[model samples]
Target: MNYSHTTLTGDEGPQQQVTMFLTRHTKTTANAIDLIQGWSDFPLTQEGIEIARQFGRGLQGTRFAAAYCGTLTRHYETARIALDNSGNDNVEIRFEPGLREYNFGSFEGRDVSTTHQAVAEWLGYSTVEEARAARGPKFDLDVQDALYALDAENMLHTDLVPQDRAESADMVKQRMWQAMTNIGDLVSREGGGNVLVISSGTAIRQFLWTIDSEVDLTYLGNTAVTKVDYDKGTFSIEQPVGSMAYYERGAQ
Candidate 1:
């Protein structure tokens, strides 16, 4: 849970496996400030922008052979800031929808701080924040639990992720696995190197789950880095979920 200013060394084995550096985006207005954000594009807050810059600085001299991100602005901006600051500023950032977050459905722009009791009444939660909280610390660690939670509220969206249904945790895992597998293959074919990925928390959680299903996918900090090793078409977690010096400059 304590993420220091560190990088995962990809020298763990022979040339068969590729090491990928996957990181959640720094705080968005929803994450660090206000408004519920799920698949919604919100620019990074002022503090978030600075944190991302620091995120880049934390890497210092580290190099990413290639970089990728989701189509959302938050994902791209975060990657731009961090990748550019990594001292290897020339890495072209690629956009891929496979790294996008779970669609929040009807809950996209709701105010998390107040006025959602009516909406939560049938959603199995007493407030909007309660439903939102279902993501991280409050997640039951069971895919069924996530399904139940999403089902309670996502019905309001006529065209939700699964057609009037909220996206299941297993669905997230599937998409993330495919995305990572594709990237891992590219890395292996091109020899091997660190591939930077800037994505959202929910997608990243599923990626981590693929590495270690027993791990509780929670507490992933803003800009936290999770490293995975892809070897001979197999993937393993190198670093599950860890942080850096985003809060305090000298901490990491």
Candidate 2:
């Protein structure tokens, strides 16, 4: 919710504007196997395809000004599917490098159960379960949360030029915030309007966490939408995680 007050010629007065929709790319094959997928570029599962399509159908009547997608195939492909299904094929899907998922480095494509142990040890926790529990009772083998936990401490290897090491949580937020700021600048300079941002759940969760520590991210399901408004100077979460209810499909 970015805002600035300005006078109108008539009595209409100033109004707030600037809107963006953030959504997680649907499930991938890695998800089925309980593997951690960070920058691995796994293709979407069949279920993932349907999830994106349903979201698109739900958005069929809505029109977007433009779209921003990560360089990965799943990210861009999800955006494409939604845009096409939403009947907005004319909107350009820009390749946004900043929107890519966290670079998990050595942990990419590894089993979460195993990596949790490794990360826990790396972070000096007795066990990954202990570290996961430290975050809160609800947090499980969530790879995103685990990474954020490590990054919260000084354990992660950041400040590297090439960033071959695991990307810090702060870095992920910076990247997403940059993407939002760029879009916000575009909208502000060119007249504000709605924009679609296709990203991953882990990344989106980190962005939300960066903004508000009280945000509850436990039940955020596939293709869930988080509405945010932004200006060049600030980005605001209009709707927090799991704000949009998914289209119902039974017994899949």
Compared with the true structure, all predictions reach lDDT values of 0.68, 0.70
What stretches of model 2 exceed 4 Å from their correct place?
1-16, 121-129, 137-162, 244-246, 249-252
Q: Please write out the lDDT profile of model 2 over residues 1-252, one tens digit for every residue.
A: 111222123323333356778888877898889887878889899988887888888787677887877788888878888898888889978777777888876556878787777666765688866876675623432455456555444354555333555676677888877776766666555556778888877677777766777777665676778888876557778755665553342112
As a TM-score, model 1 comes out at 0.76
* Tens digits of lDDT, candidate 1, 129-196: 67557644434234333443655655444455545344666767787788887777666666678888
Q: Specify the highest-lDDT model's number.
A: 2
**Which residue pairs collide, candidate 2?**
none
Clashing pairs in 1: 3-243, 5-252, 17-231
lDDT of 1: 0.68
